[model samples]
Target: MHWISMIGIALAANLDNLGIGVSFGARSTRVPFISNLVIAILSMIAAYLSITLGMVISQYVPSNYANWGGGALIILIGIYAVISDYKSNSKIQNENGITSYIHSPNKADKDNNKVISWKESLTLGVALALNCVVGGFGAGVTGLSPIMTTLFIGLFSLLTVDIGVRAGQQIAKTLIGKWFNLLGGVLLICIGLYEMFV
Candidate 1:
């Protein structure tokens, strides 16, 4: 993948991290620097593996089909994100809960002290990184370098989360967290469509 495309994929892959970060920030939860580092590293690994798998899969199919297939996968992932976000929001409404565990790394408790544990940080990192694997596959099929993609993923994951947390701190009460995922899904779907058509 070209450097520009790698950056795009990385941004899309970690967009959810912004929302997750917002959730953490709104609660005044501290995300340790180490946690950010771990998340970045895990995402890089996931990107490498997914892209390699896509490369392997590309070998078996007609080049045209492979391209469309990659696009289709991205669209499907976007659709899934949109659906999941809607369902999660609805469920939270029904439960009358202040905290949502769906599609987020932050956990809500009755106690005001809401620091995220290191274990939870690792788990969250893994969960968030899973989103990138399929995207890396899409990029891989389109001929992106795994090494460059990994670097982009690591960089974007850290940047997006940091920004999201800060922004969340400013608008935590007013912002609806699900919209972050919703926007990310829309971008993914658009990228997928663009890949298929272009």
Candidate 2:
């Protein structure tokens, strides 16, 4: 429940938002305000749930084990993120004997007409929020305040996405295209590893 812990958890949880924002912003796509709000809300809910789950588990398990478990869970989530992103980025062969790939939210926005619809925003929000759940659970197990964590996460996510989008708009594509998710995943894994040992 320390303020420092809350801040750390929030920042670690939402780093991916910057990447998402940059991806969309680089294409001049606006993530509508409502969508941003929805994303915050969704992130809050997911974080709260994960923390609550941790608290419940804490009641049944020793505090030490709970901490280790939470840390392990977060590490697993980080690995999943990296693997999933790698899979998504790889080309797939379709029935037409052509290679294709899943679209990034920004690319989808562009394909759908250079504007990101509310629904699309919600979908993006959900996807982004997934990154927060594991870290939130770990923070909760280590005695962080779920409410404060959620509040910080929502606020940080909103701000990060906004900043990322703005930065994306200014940055070159070659730079932006590089490795946002990979970096975020590595950060999460490192944080989880730190938590596990400490």
Candidate 3:
């Protein structure tokens, strides 16, 4: 029962990663495999760090306070997501006095493209990993052992996110539509608040 609950918690926490991956994949026809791999690696590292920090902090803080802190962090992330989505939707008038919709490339064009730079991959990896940690910390405060829970959460989250990215890449060329990242953001905020206060 404990393991089942832990896995469920991990899955719920990773929904943000899935949503982010979908957004990224929706914006790019080609899923950068190397970038995804880097994301996975960085997520593992962040999960490790978050779990370690949580363990140490749990010793000093009341359990309820720790949970609330985690919940607050998640809420902040949710707000950021909503803001980012809105910004992405805003129209920008180019210096050429023209406005164009941002569109992803076709699959054929992407297949012939060069690999993304390591530096770019690293930056994306770090950002995605940080997101994982914030979500992971919130889920971890439920008394599960951090190390094992972090490992499972990181691994499974990466797997699910990669799947979403790949699927998005395949259809991105044909799916030139806007996604409401704000929906996920709102969901995150509600979940975080419920966890903290309920």
The lDDT for every candidate, in the order shown, is: 0.76, 0.72, 0.57
Residue range 1-198, candidate 3, lDDT tens digits? 246434544554455456545545655533466666665677778877776766676667787787687667667867886887687679643422101111221211333353334445465456556655665665555445676666676676667566666666554455332453566466667766766776
Clashes of 3: 0
Best by lDDT: 1
lDDT per residue for candidate 2 within 1-198, as digits (tens), equals: 356557766876776777777777777778777878888888899999998887777788887787677677767767876886687668552322101101355543635676666676666777777767777887777666788889999999889878877888665366654566666666667767766786
TM-score of each: 0.83, 0.78, 0.60
- Candidate 3 colliding pairs: none
CA lDDT, candidate 2, residue 171: 57
Model 1 agreement with the true structure over 132-196: per-residue lDDT tens digits: 88888987776668888889899999997788778786757775665777877777788787777
- Lowest-lDDT window of 10 residues in candidate 1? 93-102
Ordering by TM-score? 1, 2, 3
Runs with alpha carbons beyond 4 Å of true place in candidate 1: 1-4, 93-104, 108-120
Report the Cα lDDT for residue 169, model 1: 69
Give the least accurate 10-residue stretch of model 2, judged by summed lDDT: 93-102
For each candidate in turn, give its C-alpha RMSD to the true structure in angstroms: 3.7, 4.3, 6.5
Whichever of 1 and 3 has more lDDT, that candidate is 1
